[model samples]
Target chain A: MKIHQLSVFLENKPGCLSAPCRALAEAGINIHTLSLADTKQFGILRLIVRDWQQAKTVLESHGNVVNVAEVLAIEVEDKPGGMASVLEGIERAGLNIEYMYAFTIRRGDRAILVFRFEDAEKAAQALSKAGINVIDSVALYDLVEKG
Target chain B: MKTEHCDVPFNNVSAPDFLAVAKLRELQLQRLQCIVDRAYNHVMHYRDAMEQLEVRPEDIRSLDDVRRLPFTDKTALRDNYPFGLFASPMNEVVRVHASSGTTGKPIVVAYTQADVDVWSSVMMRSFAACGVHAGDIVQNAYGYGLFTGGLGAHYGAEALGATVIPISGGNTERQIMVLRDFGVTVICCTPSYFLHIAEKAAEMGMPLQDLPLRAGVFGAEPWTENMRRRIQELTGVRAFDIYGLSEIVGPGVGIECDQQNGLHIFEDHFLMEIVNPDTGDPLPDGEEGELVLTTLSKMAMPMLRYRTHDITAIKTDPCPCGRTVRRIDRISRRSDDMLIIRGVNVFPSQIETALLAVEGTLPHYQIIVDRQQGLDGIEVQVEVTAELFSDTVKELEALKSRISHAIDSTIGLRVAVSLVQPRTITRSEGKAKRVIDRRTN
Candidate 1:
């Protein structure tokens, strides 16, 4: 299963985000899933898109210190307790969620969650067994096109 | 009964540890004979090299035969790359380690299983010379795997019958925890790392004196006598220098004994030579020149007359502790690392000596050399300790000026001063890179 995500390590500056976004636009790489994990002076732009490798190549060629990691992409209902339930399922499966960030939403009470866990395969299986309609990229693209 | 202690200082006994001396000389000759015979018989490189010198194995009779042969440089090692220098076949080689090539591409050297045993024995002497005993546990914090520091010390400490704790560098908290729980009595690490460990121990309210560490074998970088005194004082343990290179062996080709005098060369396993680096002519004893070594017992890759670039005096005078073999003083400096700042010779070791002498700053320091306005100038960026910087503004300024003056008085070269925060300079687990030569690159 492919989870198209982006990781951009940017030094804090006025036009840091603009340069990366501008780079993505220049390369014609669209950002489908995006969230910013920020610290005091720097931010990591977590992203999910159609082509993860292409996005990484485009950003890296522009001279950036970046890294790519394997993560789970989850589809949750656009409701208040959607995230809490998925996390509880992971907890029930004897797994821990290291970190998570929200990407874009497709439609009607449904959102995309980018998650990192101690064990990625196990987490995905547990969420799948919990009757969660976890959509992969093909399904996600169809949903995006439909909405 | 044959320890170095029984020998007298001024007896002028023709043999220093007559047993060790005779055994060493005999092994040295045998290894030399084998090397020459191996070169003439096995590899075409040595044959061509010796032919170019117009000398043959038959020409060499005694130890002096080494002079007739040509010296090997890093370029030669690179040209043959992988295993060009090995006298034995590549299949016989079982291990390999490399030096950190800060200057250029790293140089690789190979070792056989027998060669590995030789290296471990050398390191065993390195620890034993520093008072490491069989009953104690050893915490080897030297980086493991590709780097020779950890594993070199690792095998040697284990050979000495000490409980080996292979805690490869970093994670100071966990390192300290293991040190306390296992009651480690010996530490093997680079000098800079030991200092950083001491700082961490102080921060955690851990009484370092209460720990069981009695001695440490420190190497992989050149350190000053003053730095040695500071490490001994801070960690409450005796520390000694273990000197070697991957081209020759790792961790122990020679070692410093407890007297804190100088590193005793293990002449049995390896033969050392001092020569003028530029001219390549052998220097007389006690002359400070570039150090070169030829492996006698080396099997996989026998480095024939390799230049070490380290500057030190070799004293064969029987030490007070009674080791009759040659002992090298703490490395004065490396010819490669010598920075000619405005016609003045500047070395990091000298700067370390001066900085340790001064009172106000922490050990973390940087030398910023800049070229501007068609003239060169040097600036020393030192970190201020909380104890010294917390006083008053005048006191802080005074500290900077005082450090500048100390440097000036020592080197007779003026340098500008800039004070930084504690830990301002990056702490390195390996050799600390302190010099910022912005003059050209």
Candidate 2:
């Protein structure tokens, strides 16, 4: 139902984004999908990974703090109506979005919107009924490159 | 000139009982003027602060005129960097000491040759107040580098003409051997390190009480009367609290006399104020607030109304010793270090005191302040010795619970307790970083 997300809290500085990636490579955890929430002091580098438990262990072992939570990824069209419809379905479901960020899934025609919902289970059920191809764990694991 | 009393460390300025109380306001204004002059002329950060206060350096005359000057804080020191509040040229500085560079930035403070002498005199008085005299052989186990406590005590003992040993910190075995062989009379170090030495002495079958050491001076950290009682019982020495900072001339600005009444500030050399940290307005005596200082006799780096976030009170009750200098109660805690847990002030020092009382838990600790479910929670991870953890898991948890409960009772803040294996948190070579402030930088 959920993929492990490696959320790295980095003090907004140069080369801070690379440490988690480097640690992941060393520990051999593949990143499926990721989004970044940037702020003035620090940035949250959130990642959907194949093995969350292992990713958490690796990051903690490297002295990095990581928190695990479930996020929904809705694959939408690259067109203007694509994001608009997906957002409409999410808002229409009566699920509040604490934070939302989008990343390009493929060659720019399709975009993946990652969401943190208060009611993840209810939102997943509501979005799937709206004909939205919600990104499942199986689909996410397969998309991850075996670095 | 009363040159005989001039040599007295922490000399109390005696006035008639009624006069002392009446003159406190007069003294404050006189001191306040010193603060304004130092801020306006030397530190630009303070000068700008004074400008914002709609005050000028020339406007400050006597103590009543101090209202025109602005206050100071640690953040201002950080913003200025390196030499923001220094009152003299770098070449005039005889030495420089700094606080631990935790909490984003470290506070760097300088001392001139005269400031060093003033520090030693105050510290000498610190020792003498605790009955430290010339003939006593003093073993200064306090660390020597940077931070003021160790060397401040060291030079003061030397100035008092005591045979001094510069055995700078750690290697408990050597400290013990030196105590036995040298027959040292006075010991100086942080209160926690004193406990560490006492425990080691007991373990080694060494009778620490059998040593010639009669008294000790401890500071740079806070401790409780319970811990002090235990330390005194262990070492058979009367423990005294000596207070100062690198900004104000190191470890000997004020010290508790044999009476253990309060820290007698060298008010002539340094001015004292208890200010409302929020409003910057001065608070009257017995009013607990941030302690502010102004150095009247320093040249290297004169500080004016330097706000030392140490939370305590300035009490002028004439000591039985007959000194009129206002005595400061032992610092209960620091304002900046206060952990606002659910609108309650929870300080790590309070937690440290609790952990030290539990016997097995060492003084070294890291307090993790995290946000859970939109409410701030605390996780105190204390490292115990291998002996304490090997046999008893349940018992250790009980100790943790007991500590948490004690801290809850003391500070009105509840915290979750976690026990870790021996040597879990890295020991800092210099100032121990006992706190990991996850709440804010």
Candidate 3:
């Protein structure tokens, strides 16, 4: 399963982050999680939101260059060696992870980690073979609503 | 050989090579006759010079006959003053631009609507040669005013349909800010000034190589290959050398194409020549000498055989860009003592005029020009009178400021003015030594 994420281009200046945040708020679009990548001149704001199509439209209408990328949301044990175990499997499978981030909320004894891989399709197959519980967009949204 | 008659005169020429060269010569001849006729009829200076030499417009039948025409120099323009050299009436002249001459009086140039259009067309071609296209954001950093660099690049970028930011020089921080915010893909300015900006950008923790700027059009001063390599390594921009002078038109005369070997001259509008500086004899192709230019289509003021005094050679080899126009080597030397300080032409006589205008300063002065930390710095050392030298420090400071202000107002460049005792500056018997340039490149 894959999740859609919106990456926006913005200048690294004051109020640049709030502009899109305010736009999403006015449009009633909920952002599940967001991470900011920055350089000296500008920054890229990556957002995982519900109703990504509507959110992208809202952000673009406010003059932002937005790109949609597919990322995977997988559940991991909330133990010390959970991430290491997933990394060992990924290394054996020869799947390259570009970046990853964690969600604030979690299920009973598990945590959700969003990962961006070089090839999402192949990574999805490898994770499925490894018996990892991957959450689809609908299930992810349902989990967010419950929390 | 043509078997049948055609409406177009040269349509029957068969060989492509012959046709191309012949057609270019035909256009040059036609335009040359027109310009000479216009200059000879309207301008009194050209008329008197041509009459004294016993040469008429009809004498210029072949391109080689250009040698028969009188050579026009900067002094001729100064002699004509504000509007004497202009062939068109003042009402029809759309614009006037003045640049620093050898003396206090600046050389004035005029342009009609058609002349301005020609300038824009050539500049658009220049940008295209440098791989700049429409929709590219061009940041023009040349000084805007009577100087032609700023407005020339501005109008050309706008005419090319690119978005132009008219940020005319200075304010290095603001330049970097606008460059990053507007996603400027191209920048037009002098090479030294661009280096200064790059230095400031680095100091501000914003390196230029990280920005989206892709190309730079640098001109108005001579730069070397080493500096080009340094700029490219530092900022990752494809630096292109553009050559021009206000006496001709502006910075649209010629530019280095993607080949980056030599600058291709727009032969359709301006004719090029290289002549021996001392003898004024026309040199063959590939010989280094003085640069002479003749405007083919300028209506307001048509310059016939104007000596540019810039030393460069003509490239006889064909360019990969496929344009039939010829190319010229980059200019690295001049035949005179005119110093380009921060892209403004500075002559010793202009400095002398500025220093003499101040009350307590003597005519004995020396200009020292150097390139320190990638920027051109000029310091004027002048001798003060015995009374002014013995005066209080406050009055001496005031005199220094007045002399500096006079120079700034005359040449549009800020320079350091230092006052010295009289007779300290060595006096030469024949000619006084005025300029001492320490720049290696």
Candidate 4:
């Protein structure tokens, strides 16, 4: 129902985004997907890895402050209204989404969406009751490997 | 007949700046006794504090006995508010000046007619010490309102028999124009403001060095010796430091003699002492500590052992200027400006010094103090330099850790360091705001 995502604090500057990427690349950890949220002063780089625990330890060793967050990877149709249908259920279930991003690759006609809800447990229950398929960490890792 | 104490006799009748040391101490003791008696008899706050300490006016028999009295701090003034601390009635107070009170209500200080006369005389002496003699056209650039800097310098310059230009602060273009057109020989203002004026003068295509300005009396903010040298080099003027606060008697309490090594505190009017800031125990001469002052002759509102919060040390060696009055090291930091994080006293200047010592760092930084879970923490946000910034978090984090380590060694406490983009920190025209304390008391 949930997957581990690595959030690293970074100053918003010319070369900040390349830092953790180089760190992960040096550690031989492949980043599955990543997104950046920024203000004027700093940025938060949120990325998914096949082995987040190892990635976290490696990043920590390299002096990066890594925050691990549990996010749900939902499988949705890649067609129009696919995201809208999923968000409708989320709005109907009254679960608040703090932030959300998408995976570049698609599995068949479905796309994977990563969501950080304010309450992950309650969000899982709502999405489960809505009959939506939520991908777990093991299955997501397998899907990334197959892709 | 020439006096043994003064090589060049002062025309001012009240110039006791060159009095013999023995006679000076005797006068101080007498004035101290009188001021303490007046404060005890009139001001309820002083009387209450002295009573709590079991000290009476008579207990201050000698000059050394001032230590027995309680130390009055800024809070004492705030607690009293406007006129609560005034020893004289409203009729005798000819004028009143106040601090900017950036934190709270302005600290009000009153001066009687005699007090004003004394202020004028000391200011005149201050001008003389800085080589602003009569017939010198003085440009008083200190802000002239209730701030005490403007009017204080004004009265003193006039009393020195110099031509006074009542131009207050700001109006940089006009200030430079007057500096050129008026044949102004002396300029008085804050050191930072003078830097701005010099910059403006250069922009106007009239360099201050080319002007007739021969002397500058800069004060109202703590400035460094390096800044003084830069000002002298840029302006071609003998920059003198004038030190005082509104709580004492504006900018005439002390002035740098031609020696320029330290500022001489007029002991006949303001008795000076150096004491440990935390312990309140008096430190020996030549040791850096908090400067505590006692007004020996102020009648309107006599301050007894008032803590100035300015950090300086008394010079053990006599000044070559032949003034018997003692000199204090130039004040660059005030105890009031100190930030205590995790029980360690840290000054912004110390942080600045630490930041500049590192190999790849700019002087631009801000100290942010906050509290969480009942514990104090400090975060130093340093502007990222092109050399310090990198494409990898590893090197950037290394830079952060290096900065943190530098500050830790300088202030003796661990601090969290954050790197922000360049030019994000705000800069002010006047005194630069260096610290942002978010900790709620």
- Maximum-lDDT candidate: 3
- Candidate 1 DockQ category? incorrect
For model 3, what share of native contacts is present? Answer: 0.00
lDDT of 3 by residue, B31-144 (tens): 999999999999999999999999999999998888999999999999999899999999999999989999888899999999999888878878877877777899999999
Checking candidate 1 for backbone clashes, the offending pairs are A4-A48, A5-A47, A5-A48, A6-A47, A33-A48, A78-A109
lDDT of 1 by residue, A4-101 (tens): 45566553457767887898899997777676665443455667767778887887677554455567877777789987887777777777766787
The order of the candidates by TM-score, greatest first, is: 3, 4, 1, 2
| Residue pairs in collision within model 4 | A19-B392
lDDT tens digits, residues B1-441, model 2? 101112334423222212364475566556556646765788777777878988887787766455456656656666767876787788888788876322324568888787788777777767777777777788998777765767888888898888899998768889988987888778887776777777777888877777767778887666557767878777787889888777678877788877887888877677788888888788999899989887766766667678788889988577887666779899877777755453233556667766766664455578887654223578887654423332112344566678788766655557877654334477788556777755331
- DockQ of model 4, rounded to 2 decimals: 0.13
By TM-score, the best candidate is 3
Error of 2 at B380 (Å): 8.4
- Residues forming the 10-long window of minimal summed lDDT in candidate 4 chain A: A35-44
Flag regions of model 3 displaced more than 4 Å: A1-147, B1-19, B359-361, B421-432
lDDT of 4 by residue, B247-327 (tens): 888889999987898999999999999999999999999999999999988999899888888899999998887889999
Minimum summed lDDT over a 10-residue window in model 3 chain B is located at B5-14
Q: Is candidate 3 or candidate 4 better by DockQ?
A: 4
| Candidate 1 Cα misplacement greater than 4 A, ranges | A1-147, B1-23, B101-104, B338-441
The 10 consecutive residues of candidate 1 chain B with the worst lDDT sum are: B1-10
DockQ of each: 0.01, 0.02, 0.00, 0.13
